[model samples]
Target chain A: MPSDGITAVKQLFTRLVYSLGRETATRELKWMKQALIASHSPTLAAMLQRRLSGEPLQYILGTTPFGPLDLLTRPPTLIPRPETEDWTLRLADMLTPTPVRPLTVLDLCTGTGCIPLLLCHLWPPGSTRAYGVDISQHAIRLAADNAARCNIPSFQPAPYSQNVFIPVLGDLRDPDVFKRLLPPFDIITANPPYIPKREYDKLPVSVKNYEDPAALLGDPPDSEEQDGLTFYRLISKILRQKGMLRDGSIVALEVGRAQADAVEGILQQSAGLRNTQVWKDPWNVKRVVLARA
Target chain B: MSSPEDIARARQLKELEPLHEAWSNWTHARQSLEETLPLMQDPDPTMRTLASEEFTSLTHTLSTHISTTFPSLLVPPSSTRDLHALLELKAGVGGSEAALFLLDLLRVYVRYAGSVGWRTSIIQSSETESGGMRDAILEIKGEGAYDALRWESGVHRVQRVPATESSGRTHTSTVAVIVLPLSEDAESMSGNDELFKMEDVKVEVMRARGAGGQHVNKTESAVRLTHTPTGITVSMQDERSQHQNKRRAFQVLRARLMDVKLSQDIANRRATRRNLVRTADRSEKIRTYNYAQDRVTDHRIGLSLMNLTSFLEGDGVQDFLDALRRNWQEEVMEDVVGESE
Candidate 1:
């Protein structure tokens, strides 16, 4: 209730309002205040200065909660979106409650290794083998760090079972990237770059400034045009080249708006993936495309 | 065979016949009792003894009729018998002490739900810096959960010295509880168009996304929905999953809207009858938990029980609940008798 306290809160509110709307700014201020109070160290000015400089709150706070796992997020590697968390949980729940066999998952474009880490944590009463591949070494490192920090207890339901999460630096575009992975995986998931280049240029500063452009843009490195369906094409191409997925295994992809049908077609035509289903986010956006090989 | 309408009419007649029979029998018994009363005034010792014995038996039969038969025939079966309850507890009046007591009251309901084999989940909660509860929402699921905890919706006062207090003086802080039926009426409301329309609701997430998919990095997952006309806004940021939060918010909002409509309907229907049923009113102080006396008292039924520890632990609260339910039924029976007279 002090004058300076009022001004400080108002200043923090003003800084957040430009990037996150007025409503969100107020809410975030509340969150920050609570977080500070909870930590028992009320350094409002330091947090305010960091926010005033346009740094994302996740990085400022040093952690973001992804379901049960507290994932560590940093710059350039995409912070895990709530939409992604929503779809991943739904897909994990689709598998039968108890599985006799150990599960193997490969998450492509795995920034901060959130997808594979969560899958590993939530895997059925058996050991898990997960591979998180990203083009950025920083991302791969962060992903590895998250896997270590998550503290998922390894389980053995079979003779040769051990929980192993490997973060590999590899590009999804290259066919050789499949060689780096022990495939015939029970599950393969990707949240590849799906925003077209033209739209990426026009994105909000909060997104365009902090996150890596490669993670946002879906066009090929050498291509001028962009339709945001570049990764969907690459995913299908790699699956065809390697044929490395187990027969009738699951493959799930997070797609852009109105891209489910096209991605469904691309996956179905070549990858021999069937039983295609489009999953919607809370906002009723067709957010995830699921199929079985 | 009778047609469906004919069958319904037959059932109605079957139900009405019992009431008519009960009415006539009740009148006949009263007349016989009255005749016996006049005989008791006569000087004959045998006649007086027989009349007194008849009066005792008649009184016993009429007591059962008042307590059991009339109430069952009068009040309809409760609509909320099967509903899971959503209990909201918020601190009121006093500052930090009230919030702490609110948390204590939350635990009481939660323990009560658990002891009765009901599952309870905290959908949302907030705490003060000193570990006091600001507000909380608990979803209690089980058969007859609402029936058991229906009368719990009101302001509950706790007279206890604050844990942080050095003065050792009893503080009369209050915690308000509002219990709503968590019914699937909300889920079916989307298509029914009876309760509300999806079009009237505007949703705003904390971090808004311009376009879909891997384009943006969004961590702020708080979602707020405002029913524009009524201005009933439900914002959920907890549960760590936007999907779950959204579902919970909608369920809470829809249940609240349904409750408002249901209360109005009940009020209008009961306009002609003398007030028998007590509506859920949070402004009314329904109960008191006095720590000094080690007692819990439900003000509505004037029933009090010692051992506040076990009461808050859910053991002693059952007696108060049963009494409240019985008192309500008796009120209904009295109303029916009054109407017939």
Candidate 2:
């Protein structure tokens, strides 16, 4: 029997609620129904049923809130975890009190425009301007869509509603990106892909099977076999360029929990780097490093 | 039916039971050798290497157990103190590697303290300001902390190509540790108060400067107090308020006084020809972490654990510390029994 859209959604929603429990299930079902209503498509019912069978709601709903902005959750762009959001908020707070005029911020490996869009919305105009750079075109498109979805006033064309929010499409490993967007930034932050490639394949279905493989597993091994710290080393190199950062500029990053000492060693070896301090996550894991360049 | 030797052996074994596990690793290799007796004549170099390695390990363990268990063993202090003791360096002479081995010793102690629910704060640290720490004074506070950390007073040497080295050649450095017991009360440990007097103390207030927030700056709150008579100094920069610093300084002064009095009491007892307990030597290389091989070996009781990375990351360290402590207690008891006999 071909069930009606309302009846079908209610049934699927109840099943989802049973599987994921009341809170998550209810939220996901609401998002599904809203998406269905907005599109006015019957296929949304089948998709909601697919989600009830344990498909991640981030993929099903097609978007997730990161900081103050909603980001498109799609292929080649990793879904922003709650820990990442917490770190983003923390970095935002750290960069807020700068006395310098027009605070410039850079978000490296910025997937789906999450960090930049959130900063653009949350930051006061004229005080701060943020740029997000990512290698994946798919990711950049998702990021662009996210910025549009968040209605980033700065990126809007003519009567520029806000001061500055630019999403530059560039590879972090490439020197060209730094040459082009080589503005003096007060803060450089990234939740760079840090999980070892060997460990990525063993991740649970929630991450491995669903998330973009490229976003999760980055560049291949170098001579030293240091894979995860690739993005960090590259960023450090680019930031060392003239006029890119002021003396004692903060470079904060979210890294793998156990890599604190190793990363500290890296910063120590960095030419212009001065210090590396570890900050614990709410779980007491050594999660963030605030390295200065 | 039990003979005198049987009874003595039984007592010795009982005394060693708590500690024997730390030194009994030879049994595993001996058992493996027995199993591989069929392959004793094997011509393969790989098999020969494996067998020889196991055999050498077993022999090393056997020799250590024999020396420690000997009835007339000297049983010197494992740490350095104000007291005098005979010194001997029988083995271990790898230059820079030996020094690096010493650095590993300090790291183990630090990690062990962390495992025991104690708060170890770096009160004062003079860093190489390049890659490694030069000398760091850690103030550990917890129940029984003084007694536990008392064993850690020693000279540590480290040998490694510092992470900042471009040439990737090893360098050697040495650090000395002095672990003073922050005794609960001076009168309890010394039974007297001749060594420390308030009149002998010289108090000084100075500005604290380090890596904290506005507390490190905008204040003249840091306190540095020195005992003029004893030449002993204690700094109280942990706290922000002047009153707190004074209180902390006084507490440290009291602890140092207690330590002095206790040492003096021990000296007096020895002069009267009384038995003094053996203390661990601080100069001894207690533990070594060979990063290249990913192995950590405690040289005292000859115990080696292969999982170096996980151990340093602060997991399952309590198990090792507990085993070592129990062994040390048993070793102490064995010496007492030998004396009584």
Candidate 1 wrongly placed segments (more than 4 Å): A1-6, A14-22, A37-42, A97-99, A153-163, A173-176, A268-277, B1-86, B89-152, B155-176, B180-208, B219-235, B238-240, B243-341
In order, the interface RMSDs are 3.3, 19.0
Off by over 4 Å in 2: A1-23, A42-44, A52-54, A97-100, A153-161, A218-227, B1-341
| DockQ of structure 2 | 0.01
Give the lDDT of residue A247 in candidate 1. 77
**Model 1 reaches what TM-score against the true structure?**
0.59
Task: Quote the lDDT for A89 in model 1.
Answer: 77
Best by DockQ: 1
Best by TM-score: 1
With candidate 1 superimposed using the best TM-score fit, by how many Å does residue A100's alpha carbon deviate from the native? 2.4
What lDDT would each prediction earn against the true structure? Answer: 0.77, 0.60
Candidate 2 lDDT, B79-136, residue by residue in tens: 3222211111111344334434434544665677667676665544322213244344
Worst-scoring 10-residue span by lDDT in model 2 chain A: A154-163
